[model samples]
Target chain A: MNAIGVDVGGTKIAAAVVSPEGEILNEVRYPTQAIPPNRLVRTIADTITEAKGDFEVGGACVAAPGFVSSAENKVIFAPNLHEIEDIRLDRELGSATGLRITVENDANAAAWGEFRFGAGREFDHQVFITLGTGVGGGVITHGVLLRGAQGAGGELGHVTIDPDGPRCGCGNHGCLEALASGTAIGRRAREVANERPRSALGRLAIDRQVLGEDVTRLASEGDEAALQVLDETGRWLGIGLAGFVNVFNPEVVAVGGGAARAGEFILEPARREVHLRARSPSRDLVRIKEATLGPASGVLGAAALARGEDGEYVLGPSKRVT
Target chain B: MNAIGVDVGGTKIAAAVVSPEGEILNEVRYPTQAIPPNRLVRTIADTITEAKGDFEVGGACVAAPGFVSSAENKVIFAPNLHEIEDIRLDRELGSATGLRITVENDANAAAWGEFRFGAGREFDHQVFITLGTGVGGGVITHGVLLRGAQGAGGELGHVTIDPDGPRCGCGNHGCLEALASGTAIGRRAREVANERPRSALGRLAIDRQVLGEDVTRLASEGDEAALQVLDETGRWLGIGLAGFVNVFNPEVVAVGGGAARAGEFILEPARREVHLRARSPSRDLVRIKEATLGPASGVLGAAALARGEDGEYVLGPSKRVT
Candidate 1:
């Protein structure tokens, strides 16, 4: 059955009409409105309706950021978006569009998207790590997503890599999030530029704020200071990857998110570290690959969820697709 | 059906006739012979025979340390034992004892035992960490042991906790095993005693070689030096536990193995660190419990494996228990 997959990011909402074969037939994009919760739901409903145009949408899935309640289908806590607490988008949007709806964590949706249609398609067990503004992950074991008891099982970024390193947003010290995220990369670049004014990053900083993109650009352009920053960040990323490799022993690890676009400047060191640290059998078997779906992964995964592609949902109450 | 369970340790071979409800009807133990591969198999087979007694044992499971093959019933690599590479214990023992046999990793067996009959009985998702001579673990996700693609998934102890702390047997530095195992604790005790010659542990070390039991005993008796060692070790254990808690978010974490017998001396600090480090929701829900099954966990887990209690096997070809 054809379904609508909506990706609700902090600034924009992207929706697409997805076919049974994981292909997007049509799409719509709108800047997310941070008005009253009900209005936000209505706007999302309108977007889904527009995206569904000329075809009857059987179901829809909204992938949002933060702590989504498995039991209530509500957004419990969102760190990035404003005033979305306790928003029952699934029920509201379902009633508005006269269709069934499922709301999921954005990262989980993206990982599922990768597992079902991207780099993880051939692997039974896979882990998708996204180094976006923060480090987030999703685990698929034996062809099923592991959602734990609560819906919070795949909080990979919060795992402490260092007990006394930098503080993380999750109120913990030395989390992978604090060391390897795009935000972390930008923060480190700013710090290095401020400390060493003669550095390559400092030269870029004189024109404007040095963002993660600038660091990647400078490193690619043969800037030693930028290369050092990427090398350090990549090492930490590899350490975190090694931990995941040892724990899950997954067949494939798909690395995505905006920062991963830095390419081999970051991933090469990560691959080397994972090779150096992970144990024999898993180290020999596991493959680390770049995620292929790009910005469409979340929408594709949301569509998959709408289609009940995960076989069965283990979290809270779930409605099965006919 | 009655089944025999054999624990193939480096020093000893323990076997038992187990009832369907996990009761040990009869048990036997023998010093493991380390001459030839056939002799070792014969010793294990003989132990199973002695343990079966008058009961008709339908099948048996041998839990040994090292890498068990996914496709073939063989021990691929055993670090603790001498010259057991590529040994097909399952076939030889099956023929010798005239019963079907299954070979599993000792840690996996113990985790199964805990999940089926011990502390993890109520929880569907459980992670068992055995703080033995070397740290090892098992993962039960949705009530099935996560035996990865190649049956090496639950190598939790090899996760890098400290990058520069100590060397692990797995050829990595600062792995959780290097920092929290019974062997690590004993090494710490000896190092402390030798470094601080006038301290309580130093005085004990003067009498003889410091052991993990000696540290526990001294700590229980109010020795400041011994207490400090346990406190530090427990902190590291808690750090590793926090990582597992965040990654898997299992309902219960059962701490087993001989080193965990230190009781409150080690557990209190571990509990405290886990409380301070783990993210909310998971931190509030996860229970860190001392495994009740103790030394018998390995044998009982092997019995569970023989009964095919994991619902389905993700590793290799499995024989269903009828």
Candidate 2:
């Protein structure tokens, strides 16, 4: 059945009318507003309605950032989006558009997208990691989403890498997110550039502000300092991946997000460290690869949720739709 | 249905006739042999026959140590038990005992036992950790065992904790098993006792070889060095538990095995460390408790497998019985 999928981000909201086989029939994007919660709900509803047009839709799903409650169909908390505490996205949007809607975490949605239509399509068990500003991931085991009892699982980024390392956004110390994320890479680059002015990264920092992308570019150019930074961050990613490999024993680990765009510079070192640290059986079989869906995963996963085919997290029909 | 359950360990084999509600009707134990594999199979079958006596049984299960092939109903590998590679336990035991049989991993069996009749009975999602010689665990998520694509998931103890610390038996360095297991605890205790000869643990070390149990006894008697040893090992366990909490987000983490008999000496310090390292939301909800089933978890879990009421790891019907 055809359904609409909405990806609600901090800066923008993207919606797509997805066919039964997961092809996007139509799409729309709108700038997200820092408005009251009710208005934001309307904005999401308006976007989904516009994307639907005259096509008969079976259902819809909105992929929202932060903790989406599988039980309540609400946004429990979104740190990036202020004043949206426990917003009932499914109920409000379903009422506004006169159609049922399912709500899921953005990372989970992306993972579902990959599992169903992208890199993880061939594997029944996979760990999908998105290394953007901060690390985010989703776990699919036996082709089912692992939403914890409180719908707060798959928080791979917050797992500790070093007990005595830097502080993390989750108020913990030395989370994988604090060491291996794009933000972490940029921070390390700036620190190294400031420490050694004679290095290529330092020269770039002196010439202008250096970012994670600039470090990747310099590393590709064979700059020792830039390459060192990538190696260090990649090693941390590998160390954390080893723990996940041991715990979940997934068939493949798909790396996505902005930092993953560094390509082999990050993955090569990660593969080395993973081989060095991970145990047998799992380490021997697991393949670490780049994610394939790119920007479309979140929306497509939401659409899959809308169709009630999104793994094991059952989203019952909305009473408001009736 | 009533079933016969067997637990095969490196040193001994234990068999029991279990009632429908998991009660032990009769039990027997036999020393495991290092002879040819076929002789060992007969020993297991004889013990089960003796345990069953006149009681009628529907099916039987043998929880073998090492990797169990859920599809083949065979022991893939048992490192401690030589020449048993790919031995079809179900075929031999079923034919000898005249009953259908299922084969399962020992750790998986223990976890199923806990999930069905022990500490995990109240929680649908639980992580069962047995801190014995090496740390062994099983994962039950959403009331189903999380058997990975290769039936090798839930290798929790092998997860890397200190990337540069001691080498593990699995050939990895600084795994949780290398840091927090009973063997690790004993090794640490012996090292400490040797270093500080004036302390209580040191005196015991000078008199005789120190064991993990000696450290526990001394710690209970208020020995500073022994207490410190327990605290150190317990803290490492806490650190690993934090990572598991973030990864699985299970409702409860039940700590079992021989070392767990130390009671609050290990648990109190572990609780403190877990609270310190674990992140919010999930950290607040998870409960770390001691396992309740003791040595019976293995046999009981095997019974669960024989009844075909265990988690998602599907065991095919016995060929001999058919």
TM-score for chain A, candidates 1 onward in order:
0.91, 0.92
lDDT of 1 at A10: 83
Output the lDDT of residue B84, model 2: 52
Q: In model 2 chain B, which range of ten residues has the least summed lDDT? A: B313-322
**DockQ of every predicted complex:** 0.53, 0.49
Number of backbone-clashing residue pairs for each candidate, in the order shown: 0, 0
* lDDT tens readout by residue for model 1, B6-71: 898888999988877778889999886544554776678889988987897667888888887634
lDDT of 2 by residue, B8-119 (tens): 8988889988876778989999887544555777788889999989988777888887777765788888877654568776777778888777878899889988887788
Off by over 4 Å in 1: A34-37, A56-58, A80-84, A87-90, A194-196, A307-322, B34-37, B56-58, B80-84, B87-90, B194-196, B307-322
Give the i-RMS of model 1 in Å.
3.6
Weakest lDDT window of 10 consecutive positions for candidate 2 chain A = A313-322
